[model samples]
Target: MMDYQLNTPLNGNLAMTSCFHENKALQQDTTLYKFIWVRSGILTVEIDHIPMRLEQDEIACLTPLHHIEIKEVEGEYLTFLFNSNFYCIFGHDDEVSCNGFLFHGSSQVMRLKLSPEQSTNLNDIVRIFRQESTVRDNLQEEMLRIILKRFIITCTRIAREKCGVTPEQEKAFDIVRRFYILVDQNFREKKQVRDYADLLFRSPKTLSNLFFSCGVPSPLRIIHERVEAEAKRLLLYTPKSAKEISELLGFEDLSTFSRFFKKMTGESVSDFRKSNTTGSIAN
Candidate 1:
């Protein structure tokens, strides 16, 4: 297992993007709605723990809560991590990579890569990111919004080129889309597989089959993913105790929660909190 130590949660807000770098083997972690564009070198990228590679001129977006890292890849890439949800905009189609990674399934991410002009549009967008980044505009939020939009468009095109997706990929992508959305909404009260099946109107076995075909983990594992993500969120922001958070997140027993949390994130709840200068998560 990779010794994935999280730097910190980048807050719950969707529009506040903090720029930073990840040391190799740190398993660079952050919670943000953003995109990454590789200026140079190959980056071993992962989302939801699925890994893929990002080469030069390749752009990555539509991250549904990313757990990415640079791996052994080196050289700085222009990463324009942004939070576009703060200003609710509507644009995009559902897309998924047939190759792997499972990093993006949202429509906007589907169409946000380089264009046919052969990187002409992307070059322009990169220039904009550089310019805005240098000036540090006061309307930083909105500036990032626009720049990211352009970068996304380019990324979509690039993705379509590098990896021609398959119909099976489309099916897997849809399942992931609905699965992620449902998990986010119901992870707190409904942690069981049957709970999600009831809401999606699909049988647990059927749903499990779909996810498996799409290379997604089992439904139960999906539940743990959401719960773990929320646990990290609470650990970072709210001053909640382990017992409180476990109960709030639908865990029935404190020891069960502790065991699972440690398994998902190779750290105790208290140690995680303490690393960030927070009090022990035990009340």
Candidate 2:
């Protein structure tokens, strides 16, 4: 379980390893984005308490905000961890265009199954990544960034293809991507689809239509699911009371949040917390 890491004083951090469990420090770092590629066998992960399984030749792209628990790994895998300082997705969105589509585009974890050719391409890039990790020079950082950008571009292309996005829908796709980013950024304060629609300069109905055409979740459902996911994460991982979480999530009052939670999920806050806590303890 060898870990190869590159760290710079300017907060540039990147770590690569074949064993995902070996990097406890990186796993706990909230500021890092994670890419988990299952090269062989099965990998199980729980994101925001929802478990997912990845088979061979699959990869999951995750953002900093997600609560990720690597439950099991049955065979070989690769993990790439990097902070914003290494390469800010938002800062260089125009270059790779992965800011929204790969990381923050959906409430669910983004997993892509690689074709044989795609897997070969990724393996080639990873070889270069391993080789570059050993080199030290003034241009090492830039070189690594270039490789990372290439990796991101490859994943973005696969994602676009998997989403069935056509060239004709590229403009609409960008709008949907922007909507996802905006909802991720503002869901705590802005709970309505109309809010995001206004920010995207589209009407709520138009946003719904676009999402429908893309076969993605509806705009309102995306907002509700994002809020619900955060609520569940706080409940399962934090000691904050419901009132505190309600305030943190920008609810006017506890009752409103309580009702929203019950509507989104089928349980009250206390019950949800207790059930998950007991489950964790048992585990």
Q: Pick the candidate with the highest lDDT.
A: 2
lDDT, model 2, position 168: 98
lDDT of 2 at 223: 83
For model 1, state the Cα shift of residue 111 in Å. 16
Q: Clash totals for all models, in order?
A: 12, 0
Q: For model 2, how does the per-residue alpha-carbon lDDT over 13-59 read when each residue is reduced to its tens digit?
A: 98888875766777778888888899999999887777899899999
Where does model 1 exceed 4 Å of error? Answer: 1-32, 41-75, 85-121, 127-147, 153-164, 236-239, 263-268, 271-283
Residue-level lDDT for 184 in candidate 1: 64
Candidate 1 lDDT: 0.57
lDDT per residue for candidate 1 within 133-237, as digits (tens), equals 545445755665566555555554466444544655765555555676677667888878998888878899998887776655788987787688667757765
Shift in Å, residue 257, candidate 2: 0.9
Estimate candidate 2's alpha-carbon lDDT, on a 0 to 1 scale. 0.87
